[model samples]
Target chain A: MADHLSEPFKKSAMTNEEIMKTQREMRIQFIAFAFMIALTFLAFIAVGAEVAPPGFVISFIIFLAFIQLFLQLYYFMHLKDKDHGWANTFMVSGLVLSIPTIVALILIIGVVKY
Target chain B: MSETVDVSRGLPAHPERATLEGKNKFVGFWVFLSGEVTMFATFFGTYLGLRNGTAGGPEAADLFHMPLVFIMTMILLTSSLTSVIAITAMKKNQFKKMKLWMWITFFLGVAFLGFEIYEFVEYVHYGLGFSTSAFASSFYSLVGLHGAHVVFGLGWVLLLLIRYNRAGITLTNAPKFYMFSLYWHFIDVVWVFIFTVVYLMGIGGG
Candidate 1:
């Protein structure tokens, strides 16, 4: 058992159909990567060009950041796949818990003088 | 554990999750990642709160250089893509291709770390030491924590690559490499926020 586990296969087990499917998935991933890069560039440019108010630019860049976050988590990390229910749940819970934590800290620490 | 992995036919389509052990690692690593999300939020919240407390030190607007941050962001982002490619190749049982892409990812990560170290040195030279001010301390703690994760990840992947250098794509190492790729993507996700909340906001006069 251990020997088989460590041994390299003479050929891949993926069928031609499976290989084609994987290739298609790879293409989609590439498209997603391109979008992430575009989003990053947009965020940097939005800050660099200074075409908007500080408040607006801040929010814009943050919005872009969130889009990039979804792309990274879903596409790159495969969290969007069918078998990732538990992974998705845990990540969503973390994000849900995190918002309140961040808002509270900003309020308590930044607003209330200690 | 090895009993579950029957590789007699050929490499499994999803070699990373072929065995019960690999499946457990997959689920366990996600749980760890969830915890990490909250851990980082605390640092981020603290940084946001005290970012204004510069105490006469060089402020964010004064110290942050967009060009440097932009280049670092690009380097890290590209590394994320390379890892994605590596894992895709892994799924196809293209061992040599996967290894090549992983090496590219590793070098890109090293480049990103080099930029980060240089950025920190430049900040210290500008008098923004860890203890310089409330802002400085929180900034270092938050960004420095992320940097530490990068360092740890680089070490983890390097060790994996070296240990499995000649092992081929076995059921055991497949999960390991997949986990590292997930981790590498998570790092990029964090950097997206860092560049936005820290560097972009700093220079944008927020």
Candidate 2:
């Protein structure tokens, strides 16, 4: 069929477009990588330098870690792209269910001996 | 190949999700990973709960080495980047580049396991053996399971390399490589939490 024959032609024709898209994606990936490294450095400095209050340092690094997790999941894992709705649903639900589980585990399983 | 069976000509843009088979594989792997997330969350919850139940043995502050942990974090984070590069190569259909990046990932994984083993040995030398306390048990369970995952991931990449060295970038092998990269990224994500909650907070005496 003509359609079938043209498929290969179309694929071949998209090389330039594909390369452009790849270049864009590669740029975003490099930016995310740099941000992750900077975040890691900040986390170490927050704890190692001992400049901030202990409570603030703990919360700050945890906050930075959450940002890193989001970048890893969305960018590195490609969860932010189209057609990943089910994957996103599953991950979000897992996080939702985990909150209660974690709360109960920490509170109910009280450190009686401590 | 026959026209009837080969619905798409050449490598599809998203070969890992281009066909019915590939879509099933892509979605199914995500479903499995969701469950895995819950499994690790349970381990993490257990660790947080029992972190202070040291049974009067060495606490986290007494055993953790921040500088060594920071180096390990860097190594693992770089390996994640390398695996991402491999995935990028796959997207571009650059088989040789993908293989090279995957090999780099494998070596980084091996290096991480080596450092982890050395870390465990150091902990034991410092008198924090397996049965020392509740904290010891949970820490090993959580972090040890992660190390086990890294070992499995390394073996997987090695197998993919061996089996597909001559096969090039076929549809059959693309999804396998894609999923392996996903798994490797998941390991790095978990380590991000470990260093944050375990090492940083521990050293901070929180």
Candidate 3:
């Protein structure tokens, strides 16, 4: 009589461990958000003044901006948490295409004139 | 309720319609952003090449105003922060706060644009119109593109507000909201480079 009857399964397969894991992920996300905002603001202020040595200052500010860009994409965009492979692939593609494209253009211009 | 979804269970993977179709839209927006990055890169490279092409005119040192650009930067940067607050409100399922915060961002963006327009007008008045020199052209092209972005960004969110006037936070609008935030960040990134390479370096060097 019982042979054909199937046992009832629980609706939620998520367990205490899984729930804890999700909570941990959420906690980490919040921490990352806070950290990104804090660090970007600090650097924004640090390089916040006018200075000499034009080339050096420009390079440093670019460096800091680049840092903030990375943070924004990683944390707020949540690329780190999800679709890691696809996001990285697209980002790398942009980097590869852009660097050589820019350099080559500059070199061509260099050859053309002063 | 095409505009509604149960994100109460720790947020949906995709919000607007909460279906495969909606998720696709979210993914599509990111791809579009990559293209935007490339477009900006082209402008950046062009500016670099033409920066010194002043053609016997005033130089970057005398051209750039540190104080004006500084205030403009703060306005745009804070606008980005406000946009985050908007999204954070959205995540908490608070649609009114989300809309209010988005409007705050819109106002900040408008203020930033005002300063930029004034800055450009000031530059042109000082014998530095686009036709004055190659330096003028490059400077305008670089910062002008940023100004254009701000204008478009304001219009973008406004359209959303109008279109979704009666709707709450949906999966569709959520990604729309998220994409604007991304755009806001990209705008900031470009500005950071502008401040450093344009104002700081230009003033410090020239």
lDDT value for model 3: 0.68
Over A3-111, each residue of candidate 3 has an lDDT whose tens digit, in order, gives: 2112211122344675575556556656755654564454445445544354565566667767767766775566676545565666657656777666665555532
Residue A58, candidate 1: C-alpha displacement in angstroms: 0.9
lDDT of 2 by residue, A35-106 (tens): 999999999999999988999999999999999999999998999998999989988787778778766666
For model 2, the superposed segments whose C-alpha errors exceed 4 Å read A1-14, A110-113, B1-9
| DockQ score, prediction 2 | 0.40
Per-residue lDDT, model 3, residue B108, is: 91
Give candidate 2's TM-score.
0.92
Give the Cα RMSD of candidate 3: 7.5
TM-score of each: 0.97, 0.92, 0.80
Q: Per-residue alpha-carbon lDDT of model 3 for B1-206, expressed as tens digits?
A: 24344333534433432545555665676667677777777776766666777788878877777667777877876787678777766655567888998999999998998998888888777789887876687778888988898889889999997877667766556777777887887787678777766776666663
Clashing pairs in 1: none
The CA lDDT of each predicted structure is 0.91, 0.83, 0.68
- Looking at model 2 chain A, report the run of 10 residues with the lowest lDDT sum: A5-14
Question: What does the lDDT read for residue A107 in candidate 1?
Answer: 94
What tens-digit string does per-residue lDDT give for candidate 1 at B126-187?
A: 99999998899999999999999999999999999999998889888999999999999999
lDDT of 3 at A10: 18
TM-score of chain A of each: 0.92, 0.81, 0.56
